[model samples]
Target chain A: MIELEGLTKRYGEKTAVDHLTFTVRPGIVTGFLGPNGAGKSTTMRMILGLDRPTAGDVRIDGRHYDELKDPLTSIGALLEAKGAHPGRSARNHLLCLAQSNGIPDRRVREVLDTVGLTAVARKKAKGFSLGMGQRLGIAAALLGDPRILLFDEPVNGLDPEGILWVRTLMKSLAAEGRTVFVSSHLMSEMALTADHLVVIGQGRLLADTSMADFIARNSRSYVRIRSPQRERLLDVLHQAGITAVESGDGTLEVDGDKAEHIGELAARHQLVLHELSPQQASLEEAFMQLTAESVEYHAHSGTPVSPQQWGDDWKKG
Target chain B: MATVQVVRSEWTKIRSVASTVWTLSLAVVVTIALGMLISALARSEFDRMSTQDRITFDPTFISFAGMSLGQLAMIVFGVLVVSNEYSTGMIRTSLAAVPQRGTFLFAKLAVATVLGLVVSMATSFAAFFLGQAMLGEHRASLGDDGVLRAVIGGGLYMTLIAVFSMGVATMLRSPMLSLGILVPFFFLISSILGYVDATKDVVRFLPDHAGSRIMQVVPPVGDDTPYGPWGGLGIMVLWVLAALVGGYVLLKRRDA
Candidate 1:
């Protein structure tokens, strides 16, 4: 178990991580979600004692990171893919790390095979692609088979198959009763993998809840109804004391899971229903809603200005 | 964790990279080869020298002249050993494996310094013998007074140079920045300062100048240096200690 209590880090006047207190428990994948420039990376660094926390404590198995004997055996981390020296062979890279923690040499080969890099074990890391580099990093993290594992942006450069493989790997690792904490900006990816979520925005905690609960609380689930006798259906819904808002596409959207009630009411009134479906907001929309106020770098969505506008602005300047 | 494990791990790290082999090879080859070339030139030109030049000619010191240039390679080796961790983003992983910063830094330095000592000793011995062979009748043997000490000191000098470079590299944490400052400071600035009468006193305190004094078996004409060979080496050791301590303090205080 990894416990962070009042973990904080600041750079001059800028607070990179602010009072981040969350416990990553065993036997579950805890997704660390945030917008760009959030404190996910900084928080991970502090957990490993790579960055000195401004005012707080992080403990692995109830001991400070530095106090843990052979800390790799307690908590393994893949902070970045380019953690290996480009000139060193993959085998040697893992070998050195293993030796540092008193892990045997055979484990290096085992991790290499586990990551599917055994064929290129002797090759230097400079030749490896982004996906291969990520694999090597994961191999290093798994070298000691620690109870807690941390991966930052693990699937950033992976292909579809590689992404699936990483998802499976993370899930299996957690299933072995290990604490798996992964950080990513990809909400869709987290929805598929993460069992629990600890979300932050602009260095502040926004939500800490289970995957299902988070989406349910932050988003709206509504039932959409379409009928041939739209006027009659509207009257029936109103008479039944249910509010229905007309959608832009000529369908009525009721702000609750009233699909069954609405269907029975329409049938009782001899209303011919064309479509009746309930829509639960996806995790993506929930994340956007939760973080919309705190996103640091916002990209405005619109068409580009025409050349004439650019010319006119230039002339005015 | 035991310090021995970290030491062994650091050994693996140093030997696994091609830079270690290439840099040390360059140091040895350049030192020995250039020493021979200069020794050969000195032998042929002995007849044309003035009386004082011939009187003060120290064959032991002459053979080790190649270190003036060869030590640059040693510097590169030392700098890369420490700074490559930072440059390649490996320091985070390394520190994660062994979270004790002092143990990690010192173990790495110890391993690199031992390797530097071995290569420097081999190069020192080879340069002396081959340089002496080229000098022919002007050769200085191990049996000669102060000759063995000077030869051994030559090895110590090169090793100290590499160690000093490692200390500086640890402080800088960037190979390019470390090399950019170290190479020119040792090669040009120190030399220029030593050449100018106004700055000669300051230059003697510099790490390279004080350390290289160990190679001198006989003083130059009109020699008035305040420190003996051992004293000069002591000064250099102090410089190395200062650099290492500064590096350690900074590394402890800063984020990885």
Candidate 2:
């Protein structure tokens, strides 16, 4: 378990992390979501005691990071893929870290095999691909088999196979009752893997809720309908007290999951319906909606800034 | 965490890198090879030396002349040992493994210092014996007054050079910047200042000048140095201590 209270980090005049308070509990994958420069990396560094917080406290398993006996055995973190020395072999890199925490040498080899890098374990890290380097970092984090694991952008440079492998690994680790905290800007990936989410925007907490609840609250889901007899469909819907808006693509959009009711009304009126589909907003759209205001870098390509119906624009673009 | 575990870990770190082997070997080869060459040269030119030069001729000190060049390699070794962590982005992982900043820094230093001492002592003994062989008749025996102290001091001097470099590297945190300052300061600037009459007094207090006094068996003619051999070494040690303290304080306060 990792607990942060009133955590803040400021660099001179600029505030990097502002009053972040959240608890990452065990038995689930907690996704840390934020836009670029949103302070996810800074917060992780503070939890490991690598960065000194400007104001606040972070604890791992109810004790300060430095006070933990063999801290690696309590919490393991993979902060960056290129953390190993270029000249040192993968085995030796893990060996030194293992030795530091009194972890045995055998465990180093075990982690090597676990990460599927045993064949290249003797090779220097400089020669490894970015995906391979990420595997090595994960091996280091799993060296002590700690109860809590933290990975920052774990699948950044991975192949499709590697991405699936990492997603499955994170889920299995969480299923074993370990607290798995991962940070990424990819909301689609988080929607697939994360059970809970802690989102931030411009260094401030935007939402801390379950994945299902977050999407339900921040996004709009509607039913899209297209018909040959548009006037007849509009009249039946107006009589039934249903309001429908005509989209730019000649489709009528009704708010909420009223597809079944609309479909029954169209059938009763003998309306020839070309299409009837319920459109549920993805986590990506929900994330954009939540962070639209706090996004630091805005693309100047005349993209719509409003969150309400930007999904259509995004799809068209 | 026990200090010994971190120490063991540091030993693994130092030994695993190729830089450790090549740098120390270069120091050994350069120190020994250069000492022998200079000793042979001095032996051939002995007859043409001035009477005053003959009076104050120090055979022990002449053999260790290669140290001026050889110590640069020691500096490189020391700088890389500490700065590699920062350069390769390994410091974050290392700090995460051992969050106690003091223990982490000191444990690495302790391991590197021990290795430096062992290699330096061996190189010192080799250079002394080989240079004496080249000098032939003018060779100073180990049993001679102050000869053994000078020999042992030669090893201590080399090891201290490496340790001092480690301290400075920790503070500077960049191999290029640390080497940029340390290499020229010790190799060119210190020697040039020592030669100039106006700067000679102040230069003596510098780490290298103060530390090298231990290798002199016979003081130079017109020598007016205020400190004894041990006193000079003590001054160098003080400089090392200051650098280490500054490094520790910075490491404690700054984010990794």
Candidate 3:
């Protein structure tokens, strides 16, 4: 498990990471989500003991990374895919990292085979494609069979098949009772792969909840009704706890009411309801709503800022 | 044993890189080729002299005459060894693998030191014999006084220069910048420093000045410093320590 207490980092005048506290439990894949410049990378670096925190501390398996007997075995990290010396051969590159962490030499070949890099192990890293370099980075991370793994943007530049492979690999590692924490800005993938979600924005924690709870608590439910007498239904829904408004077509839009509730209400009122259905919020929409604020370095383009623009302020419990 | 493995890892990394081979080869070729050309010209000058004006050319001098050019190439090779990690964003991986920064530095020192030793030895032997063959009459062997010391000193001086360059790389953390400053400062400026009385005191501590002093059979003309050959080389070693320590201090205090 990994834990952070009051952790913070300041780059000159800007506070990149604020005083934040959280825990990453074992036996599950925890996805860290944030907008660009949201401090996810900074936090991970602090966890790995690469960058010193301006305040507080981070611990892995109850000890700092430097205090671990063998850091590679304790925690395998793919901090950046382009982390190897470009001049070194793939095989020799892994060999050097393995040797530094006291890993046996056999593990080097095993990881190369696991990642399907054995074919190009003798080739220099400068020659490898981005995908191949990513594979090498993953191979190095898994070389020690670590109990805790940290992957920062691991799915970037991967093809569809490669993405699926990584998703499955993360799940399997967590299933084996290891702590798997992966960070990415891609919400679609996180919704599919992560059992737990840790969301941050503008250098502060926004949400720390199980995927199920997050969806259930934050998502919106609505009712859509199609009827020739849409005006009558609108008046009737207004009397009920649900809010209803006229749709562009001859239909009624009911807010905070499910299909069954609207149907029963219509039946009791003896109204002719042509259509009654529930509209559920997608995980993607819920995520946008939760992290509506704290986005830094916004891209100016034709695309609209997510509905999160509606939520100018966010809070976490 | 772990440190030994670290050293081995550093060696593999250095050898696998093509720059290591290219730069070291440049060190050898430039040293030998330049020595041959320079020694031949000096001998031609000796032959035309009147009998009374004959100034005997030192045999060891002509053989190791290429020290000036050889040192520059070795310096390039040394700087790249450490600086490439920073330029390519690989130091994060390196430090992550071996959390103990000291171990990493030690491994680099060992790999760079050994490679420097090997290249210097090759260039020394090749330049000495080739230059002697070029000198039709004036030839010196290892058996002569200070001839053995000078031959070994030539190689030793080149090795120290490489190590000194490694320290500069660590401090500067960029190959181009380190080599840019090191080359002109050592090759052009240090020798010129001797001409000005005010700069002479500081020039005594210049790495190439102290290191190049070892190659001289007798101190070069207009020399003001009192350091003998070994003591001068010792000053170069002192330079290596200063740079390594400076880098370490910076690495310790700064954010990774």
Candidate 4:
């Protein structure tokens, strides 16, 4: 288990993480969700004692990270894909980390097989493709067989097969009663993989709720209706004390389970119905709405900023 | 984190990379080969030397002349060993594994320093013997009064050079920036300063300048150096200690 209490980090005048307090419990995969620059990486670094927090503290397994006899055995992390030395072979890379934490040498080869990197275990990381590099990182994370695992954007540049493999690995690890905390900006991926969600925006906690609860609270479900005799339908709904929202294009959206009532009312009024269907908002829309204000870069059509321009803008802010 | 585990881990890290083998080999080959070549030239030119020049000529010191160029390779080895972690972003992973900053830094230094000592000692002895062979009748024997001391000091000098580079590299945290400063300062600036009458006093205190004194079996005639061999080495040790403390302080405070 990992617990953070009032954790904060400030880089000069700008705050990267603010008063974050949460617990990552074992036995489930917790998805950390935020837009770019939301401080997810900073928070994870603090948990691992990589970055010193400006305020408060974090404890791993009820002790400070440094106090643990062997930290990797308690919590394993894959912060980035290319964190390994490019000149070192995959097997040797894992071997070094394993030796540091007193993990046996056999664990290195086991992790290699687990991640399906045994074929290239002797190859230098410099020659590995993006997906292969990610696999090596994952293999490193599993080297100590830590109970708590933190992965930052683990699926960033992976193919469909690799993504699926990561998703299954996360699930299986969680099922083994381990604490699996993974960060990603991709909502669709989280929706399929995570059992719980801890979301942030502008370095502040936006939501910390179960997956079902978040979806149920954020996703909007409504009844849609369109009619050629719009005036008659409006009169019938007003007489029946039903409020209908006129969403342009000669259509109306009514909240709640009013589709059947509206249909019966329209039939009795003899109004011609062009379209009447229930509309449900997707998780993607809900995520966008929650993070709209915190989005740092606005994508303006026809005036697309080059990659270098985007980097410059980020530096300016 | 146990110091022993971290040391073992650092050993693996140093040995697994290609740079370690390449850099150390280059240091050995360059130092010995160049020393032999210089020794051969010095033997041939002995006849043309003035009486004063011949009187001041130290055979033991002459053989180790190649250290001026060879130490640059040692600097590269030291800089790469420390700065590669930062450049490749492995420092984050490394620190996370061993969160005790002091243990991580010191363990790495301990492993690298040990390797540097072993390789440098072998190189020093090999260079001395081969260069002596080239010098023929002018060669100083190991049985000579101060010859063994000078040879052992040559190994110590090379080891200190590499360790000093490691300390500076730790403080800088970038291989290119560390090399940019260390290479020019040791190779050109120190030597240039030593030749100028105005800068002679200050140049003697530089790490390389003071440390290289150990290889001198006989002082130059009429020379008045401030410190003796051990005292000069002491000055170099002080410089190395200061750099290491600065590096540790910075590493302890900075975010990985």
Candidate 5:
């Protein structure tokens, strides 16, 4: 269990992390979600006591990080992939860390095998590929078999197979009643792996809720309709006290789960409907809408067109 | 955690890297090989020297002549032992494992210093025997007055040079920047300053100048140095201590 209360970090005139307070509970994979530069890395560093916090407190398993004897057995972290000496072999890198905490040397070989790097364990880290380096980092994190594990951007450079492997590993680790806290900016990835979500935007807490609740609250679900008798369908919808929005592609979108009602109405009027499908907003859209105002860097090319303009242009046509 | 565990861990860290072996071996090989070459050259030119030069000539000191060039390798070893953590982003993982900053830094320094001392002692002893063989008739034996102390001090001087570099590297935190300043300061600037009458007094206080005094078993014919061999070493130790304390203060106060 990792607990943070009123955590804040500032650099010169800029605030990097602001009053972040959240408890990462055990028995689940809690996703720490934020845009780039939203202080996820800074917060993880503070949790590990690598960086001094400007204010507030952070604790792992009811003790300060530094105070914990054999900290690896209490909490293990993979902060970045390049955290080992480039000239040292993978086995030696793990050995040094294990020896520091009085862990047995035999565990080094075990972890190397666990990460599937045993064949290359003797090779220097400077020669490892990005995915191989990441595996070595994960091996380091699992060296002591700690109860709490923290991973930052674990899937940054992984192929699809490697991604699935990590996703399954995280789930299994959580199932074993360990607190698994992983941070990433990929909402679709988090939607698949995270059971709980703690979101931040511009260094402030945006949401702390279950994954189901977050997606349900932030996204819009609607019924989409396309018909050859578009004008007749609009009149029928108006008389039925239903408001439908016309999209640029000539599809009508009603803001509710009214697929059955629309289908019944079309059947009654015998309208020649071409397409009728229910659309629920994806986690990507929900995350974008929630963090749109707080995104630090915005690309100017091909910015999304406003929906109000779509309405105005439709009325003009 | 016990300090012994950290010490063991630091030993593993130092021995696992190729740079540690390469730098220390380079220091040893360069010191011994060059010391023998210089001794042979000095023996050949012995007859051309003035009467006063022959009377005050120190054979033991001549044997360690290669140290002037070899100490740079020691400096490189010292710098890499500490700065590799920063250069490769390993410091974060290291500090996270052992969060007591003082223990982490000191254990690392202690392990490196011990290795430096062992390698340097071997180099010092080997250089003395080989260079004496080259000098033939002018060789100083271990039984001569102050000869053994100077030989032992030669090893200590080399080890101290490496330790001093380690302290500076900790304070600077970049291998490139530390080497950039330290290499020129010791190799070129200190020697140049010692040669000029204007800067000779100040040069005596620099780390290399004061530390090298320990290996001198005989003073020059018109020598006027204020400190004895032990006193000069003491001054160098003071410089090392100050650098270490400064590094510790900065490390404790700053964010990693």
Candidate 6:
């Protein structure tokens, strides 16, 4: 487990991370969610004892990372994709880091094979592509076979197959009772992989809860029904004490009713329904909603349109 | 000890980098080859000169003429060993692995010292043999007066100079800056001091000037400021120690 208490980091007049206190528990994948520049990387570095926290401390498995006699065996991290030396061969790179923490030399080959870089292990890292470099970084992290793992933006440059591989790897790692803390701005990816969520905004802790609980509070769910007699469907929903809004597509968006209940109501009303589908707020929509005002860097492309405006055409039956 | 581990890691790191091997190889080849060329030319020139000018032909310094040029290559080798770490961003990984800043510098110096000794010894030996062969009948055997002394002092002195170069490299992390400062100090300041009578007293104590006294046959032309061969080596050793301490202090006080 990794624990942070009142952790803070400031750069002169700017605060990078502010009073971040959270426990990243074991046996599950905890997603650290934030928009760009929300201090996820800063917090991870603090946890690894790379950056000195301005106010408080972070501990891994009940001890500070540096104080641990062999930290690599307790916590593995890929804080930056380019952390490895470019001149060293991938194998030698792993070997040096392994030796530093008393890890056996055999572990280097194991991690290289595990990451599917065995064929290119002898090649210098300067020749690696972004995805290849990310794999090497992950290989280094797994070299110690530690109980805790931290990855920041692990899937940034991966292909579809590589993305699936990373997602599965993270899930399996958590299933083995390891504490896996992954930071990403891709909420869609995290929603599928992370069992729990810790959302931060502008360097402050905004939410820390199970993924289910987070969605329940921050996301909205409803049913969309389009019928020849849309007005009749609306009337039936209002009479049943269900709030229905007339969507831009001329459909009745019925809230407070499941898709099954809405279908049964339309059947009873003898409405010729063209469409009846359940719609839950996607992780992307929810993320945008939660972090709208707190986004650190706003795109200056003039007139920012809402996500709903962009996705409304696809919402039509 | 963790320091030993760091030293081992540093050894692996420096040796693994291709430039380390290349630089050291160039230093050896350049030293030996240049020593042969200069030795042959010196013998021919000495033979052609009038007998009156032959009094200045002290063969000891002539045999090690390569030291003047070879030291430049060794200095380049020394600077790159440290500066390349900074250029490639490997220093961050190294520092992160071994967070004790002073210990890291010690390990780096230890690696450089061992490498310096090996390269210096190899180059010195090769240069001496080639120089001796080029001198023909002008070459003095090891049994001659102070001949063995010059041979031993030649190799040992070169090693000390290389160590001094490595120390300076550590103090100035930028290889080019160290080279810029080291070359002028060796080729310019010391030579200009040699032409004058007054400043020679202080300038002889400077790193290269005082150290090269070990390789000379006569007592540094005309001066009472001359130290014994071992004493000259001691002066260079002092310079190395002082550079190392200053490097350590800077490392400890600065952020990586």
CA RMSD of all predictions: 5.7, 3.9, 4.6, 5.6, 3.7, 5.9
Selected candidate, larger lDDT, 1 vs 2: 2
What would the per-residue lDDT of candidate 5 be over residues A1-317, giving only the tens digit for each residue? 99999999999888899999999999999999998988999999999998899999999999999999988878888885479999999999999999999889999999899889999999999999889888898998999899999999999888898899889999999999999999999999999999999999877788899999887886789999999999999999999999999998999999989999999999999998999899998888888767774443232235543555545867999
Which scores greater on TM-score, model 1 or model 2?
2
Candidate lDDT scores, in order, read 0.91, 0.93, 0.83, 0.91, 0.91, 0.78
Which run of 10 residues does model 1 chain B get worst, by summed lDDT?
B217-226
lDDT of 6 by residue, A21-61 (tens): 99999999999999889899888877876667889888888
Q: Residue A37 of model 2: what lDDT?
A: 85
Relative to the true interface, what fraction of contacts does candidate 2 keep?
0.92
lDDT of 3 by residue, A234-308 (tens): 777778867776668767776775788788878898899888888777777776766663442223334445544
Q: Across the candidates, what are chain A's individual TM-scores?
A: 0.86, 0.89, 0.85, 0.90, 0.90, 0.86
Error of 6 at B7 (Å): 3.5
Q: Evaluate model 5: give its lDDT.
A: 0.91
Candidate 6: tens digits of C-alpha lDDT, residues B148-254: 66667776666666666667776777778888988787767778997797986888788777777676665433447668777887887898789878777776654
TM-score, candidate 3, chain B alone: 0.92
Model 4 spans > 4 angstroms off: A248-250, A293-317
lDDT of 5 by residue, B1-256 (tens): 7788899999999999999999999999999999999999999999999999999899999999999988999999999999999899899899888999999988999999999999999999999999999999999998999888888988999999899888888889999999999999999999998999999999998888898898888899778888889899999999989988988888877777
lDDT of 1 by residue, A124-207 (tens): 999999999999999999999899999999998999999999999999999999999999998999889999999998787888
TM, every model: 0.92, 0.93, 0.90, 0.94, 0.94, 0.80
Local accuracy of candidate 2 as per-residue lDDT tens digits, A31-57: 999987889999999999999999999
* Full candidate order by TM-score, most accurate first: 5, 4, 2, 1, 3, 6
**A1-317 in candidate 4: lDDT tens per residue?**
88989999999998899999998989999999998888999999999898999998999889999898888898889996489999999999998899889999999989999999999999999999989989988988888889999999999889999999999999999999999999999888899999999998877787899999988998888989988888888888989998888988878988877788888888887888998898888998888777763443234435535555767988999
- Evaluation by DockQ, superior candidate among 2 and 6: 2
Better of 3 and 5 by DockQ: 5
Number of clashing pairs per prediction, in order: 0, 0, 0, 0, 0, 0
Interface RMSD of each: 0.8, 0.8, 1.9, 0.9, 0.9, 2.6
For residues B1-256, could you state the per-residue lDDT of candidate 1 as single tens digits? 9999999999999999999999999999999999999999999999999999999999989999899999999999999999999999999999999889999998999999999999999999999999999999999999999888888999999999999898999999999999999999999999988999999988898988888888999899888888988999999999999999989999999999
